[model samples]
Target: MTNNMKNVFDSSNTYGMAKTFVLISLYALLIAIGMHKGVKIFLYIAGISGALLLTYEWFKMDRPSIPTFFIAPLLFLIYVLISPGTFLIDARLAGRFACALFAGVALQFFFSNATYKVLLSQCAALLTTLFLGVTYACIWAPEMFDDRLILSYRNPHQLAVAGAFSIFTLFTYLSIFSKKKQLLVYCLFVIIGTAIFMTVSRSTSLGLLCAFAAYILFYRSKHLIKIVVAAGLLGLIAFSILPATQQQRLIDPFTAPLNDRTIKQRVGIWYTALQGFDEAPILGHGLRAYSDYDSDYKEAHRAEMVDKNILIIDSRWAHPHSLYLGSLFGWGIVGTLLLIGAFIPAFRHSSGRIKTFLFLMTFFSLGYGLTELRIKSDDGAFILFFPLGLAYGSILFEHLSQKNKTTSEYPIQTKPCITKILTLLN
Candidate 1:
């Protein structure tokens, strides 16, 4: 065996199984404890543990795939110097993001290893099936549910994100490698789409709509104008049949200012974030500095509004409602630029399907970020990084050719090459 191949299949490594089990275990634990308000301590512990394990594995590498993984902790290190005496925020909250980067980078290392890759594919499949089941229950038994069918999520928004992400991954899989199963994939789209509707998450709903439109426009454009006309007619017909309240829910965001308190507050929050960004233009006021300063911002807004005879009631909200602005506030201009720098090289090197997956992930996250702060939130960090890691891992596998070899422990000859089942994920 060549030295590189030997490095790829090292005795120190457990052929990706051990890494897969550890990453997935942490992911599951995050999902379970993430929604609890005061369980951040657990997340911090998980982050530190995961980081230490990955760091150890990293040291065993002879050749590490694209060093893009260094950006998160690099930014974290900068935050350490510029922190606003808020190590708790740095260690516990923003640390999830660092952990996520570690996971993604760690995942990249296992791309040539079949066992880890299968873990990711199996995970996507499991989530899709669960979403289908939840969708079925919501569609057939409306009376048994409340306004939204959240399944086990703390809120409908979480359910929506999971459904939308699963549906996107399923389609990506079909387009890239599962062409023989196109019909089955379409069926899944229908099932998952119903639950997305049930969630009533405006961000995910709108994002899904745009993604579907883009897919049809780009891929199935044989009769582009005709398809557009048919879609328009169908949309109008559907709109006419909906009840007045449902119609308003869909239409008010575009037409009525009074109906979009969410949007208005988002605008206000974005403005304040910009103001904060100006103060800490280099390194930021530190992690969650916005949270600490938000009350003062609201007071300033109320004071200004008093002169205009405007009463501000219940004006509290979370981080700036944007990926760009949230990064701007937490990491500042330099830090934000470093974060972007990390993604660019990996993106340029990625193959087609990998790029497609990453693009959709970015699109959905950015779309939602316009109205809510994700990517740093509990559920957001987990959902975002796992697939991101998979994407980076795909690039790594592409760089190194796959080969099957039997392990001494198993004695059974299973395919060592990941491509036998799923080529893209591993």
Candidate 2:
């Protein structure tokens, strides 16, 4: 076997798997702990480690695929560093985000092929575990049954986690069913869905429904009508059979009104952000600096408002909740454009079906961000970008010749002529 070929098949040196495991484990732990910097630190170490390995591999003459589109964001990140204030409020946050991005890029370079699949598998497994475990506890924990077993009873974080697990389970099913990994996938999905049903995040329920419709309409369009009927039937069965908390969660989106505290707060936040944007239309106040200035905004608004409690209540929540608005508010037109630039390649290369899914995620996030920042924080950032990155990276990798076709299957046997010649010459 050629030296390069030998390197590719080396079981102990699979860069891809390493990257995947690190990313998945870190993300899972972050979600569980709510420590954003911890995740970044982990990635930073992984990136450095991967870069070192990549350097060694490069010496062996293996060609790595360069992620051409990432340049736009990288350049913009640099611009943030050099550009004076009014553009960036907290340079540290911008720098940190850039560091995180570089770490991810380093991972891509170090294990371009293996990371995507491994990350997917990890996401499927980790989310499945969390969902199933939580759901099981809620359903069977005799001691806590009254307080914690029900869906709405769970805290917001749990609800979000459960909702995420639901999506993960669905994706896992698609991955398995598409790839013919049937029995395991089926069992996993059931566990995941049940867990999600327990969280009772109404928005999650809505997102899942929308995702299902999109999945059927585009990817499985031929069986669309039947699938919808089956889904409707399944929904009916689930609501009828499941706990009241679960049922209530499933119908939450339609139930949450504009006057609801959460919704009302989001409106207030939107107005606050709009005012911030107005102060600087071209560039944002600065990345990750929203909360730093929210006090002043709230105080000013309070002076003109009815109640101090209403003006400042729940203002502890940072971020405007909408990513697009947040980006504009923080990074301005430059940052927003850079992000759009980064996403463009993925969009261009993706099929209509894949693109539709991306759009759903992006769209939902936009509205959802108005209430919660799901893309800026570390855990949220990983959750937001990793899967989408994987999906997009998968599309990008598919077009490349180097990506492995079957990770599970043994590689074909072949002689390493280059290695033989190199040894002889040495």
lDDT of each: 0.58, 0.52
> Can you give the lDDT of residue 19 in candidate 1?
45
Among all candidates shown, the one with the greatest TM-score: 1
lDDT of 2 by residue, 97-119 (tens): 55444444433433344343434
The deviation in Å at residue 378 for candidate 2 is: 1.5
lDDT by residue (1-426, candidate 1, tens digit) is: 355654555553444445445555444443443232322444444455556655544444433443455454355445544554434455555566665555554444443353233333533544554556557766886553545556656777776776776676666666444556778767766666665665567888766666666666766778778877976775576556545655677677879955566666665677778878887788676546776566686676777656644334455555776778888887777767766765666566666655676667766776776666766576577555545655665654554333322112223233454223223333
For every model shown, what is its TM-score relative to the native structure?
0.72, 0.68
Let me know the TM-score candidate 1 reaches against the reference structure.
0.72
Full-model lDDT, candidate 2: 0.52
Clashes of 2: 8
